[model samples]
Target: MAYAPQEVVDVVRMAACLSLNLGTPDAQRVTSMVSAGQEANLRGIPVVLDPVGYGATPFRKHLCSQVLRNVRITVIKGNVGEISQLADAGGQVRGVDSMPGQIIPLAAAAAYARALGAVVAITGATDVVTDGRRAFAVDNGHVYLSQITGTGCTASTAIACFLGAEHLSPTLSPASAPAPCPAPATAAPSDPCSSLSPDPDTGTDPSAEPVPDQIVLQPHAIPPATPDTPSTAGPNPSPLGATCVTAPIPSAAASSKPAGDHEPPPYLTAVVAALAYYGACAEEGAE
Candidate 1:
């Protein structure tokens, strides 16, 4: 059954994040994936893309590149062979499996992250996750993880889940947000020029003689009466909708302090934590 564009857009908007995998990729899947990914981008939803078997065939590589080009992917999870292909470096893949000597280097992974402007995760014996500037090496998981056909696909899902959680959490909590905006009274002193009013006691020429009842009221001089029915003259400055209080965004250096002094960023923490959890579970299953 085909999905309506509005329905797809609504689904993307309501979702916290999106995960796309090309394990069984085809023309229809590629079209749908691009559409969904673009909608997710428009809604500011983080997206995780897993290019399964990317180097297995020329068609796979082309389709993967097309999707990446069209959407602003937040994170990319792939095997060493797939990432190597993406970097346009020498890589060998035989039916979706990396060749024995085609391991991806940590430096190259970091470069890919910088080039794509997205988190790059290259999984192997030593998984490397990078955001261009910082590279994290996670030495986790069990050999049995490789034995499983969809572990990489599942990892992408886990990463997307963590991203979604981080997106939902407030970047600046009450304790870290800049002090509440000062009361309107103290925002700024009334402008001296605007506050200046006509003085009835003193004439324009201070030395001039004062004359009683000299001030003649003009037709526009009277204060208009408040209409019983509120005036709808034009646009209202403060509309009836929700009132938003905008605060200056706290700088990263200032907001870095956590419950503990050295906690990592929420998304980084999530990635590390998810990898650890997956490793623990895989080791347990292996045992």
Candidate 2:
């Protein structure tokens, strides 16, 4: 059955993230994937691409090229061979399996990330995640994970979930964040002789009442509004139905620019975290 582009677009409109898989691609599926990816991009939703078996066939390679050219992918996740193909390092892949002794180096993975302007994840015994600058290695998965089917695809889903949570969730920018409440003023010491007559009958001075050692005025803390919280921070800055895509994949030269001393980007961090979590889950499952 042919896939409907409009239907795919509609689904992506309501989705926090869009994941495109080439495991079973057909002409109609490819069209749908491209349409959905573009729609996701327009809405600023994260897009995760799993180029499964990218180097196994010419058709698959062509499809991968088309998607990369058109869609603004947030993450490109695949096995070492698949990632190597994208990086132009020319690794070997038989069917869907990554051939041994053809691992893509960390530097090559980072270079591919730079060229694509997205986070690249190469899964293996030690998964590598990079955003062209900072690189991270996740060594938490079990060897048995390689024997399971769809594990790589599952990793892509996890990364998409992490990216969606990071990007789609409403956050208070520095400008919109509420300022801290000021400290309350301390009461001045009461004057002893200010009152003309102490207390006509009782000789005790009314103004000289004892003051507590420390007057603590509690400031009511205003918790930041979350997505579920009522009266959110004046509509989310990156609302789900936003009109246009804020960040598209840049050119290789543009993306290759130095990142200075700033920390890794949110999308890169999300990818790394996802891989770590997925690997940990695999280890538990093996046990």
Best by TM-score: 2
Which candidate tops lDDT?
2
Model 2: worst 10 consecutive residues (lDDT sum): 236-245
- Expressed as tens digits, the lDDT of each residue in 1-287 for candidate 2 is 22577599888878888889998887778988889889888998889999999989999999888888889888899988888887877788888878875544444556567667788778887666667665544555678878877889888998888787667445647577444212112223232111111221243422233322221111111221133423322232111111111223344455435444223334765676577567656655677
Please give the distance, in angstroms, between residue 13's alpha carbon in candidate 2 and its true position after superposition: 0.6
The alpha-carbon RMSD values of the candidates against the true structure, listed in the order shown, are: 26.8, 21.5
Tell me the tens digit of each residue's lDDT in model 1 across 1-287: 12344466667777888888888878767887889999988888888889998889989988898899999888888877788888775677676666654454444554566567687777766565656444444554687776667888888887888688667656657576544322222332222211111222223321122211211111011111222423332231111101111123234465433232222222543554455446555655676
- Model 2 ranges off by over 4 Å: 1-3, 171-265
Cα-based lDDT at residue 203, candidate 2: 36
* Weakest lDDT window of 10 consecutive positions for candidate 1: 214-223
Candidate 1 residue-wise lDDT at 284: 52
Question: Any idea what lDDT model 1 has?
Answer: 0.58
RMSD in angstroms between candidate 1 and the native structure over all alpha carbons = 26.8
TM-score of 1: 0.64
Clash pairs, candidate 2, are: none
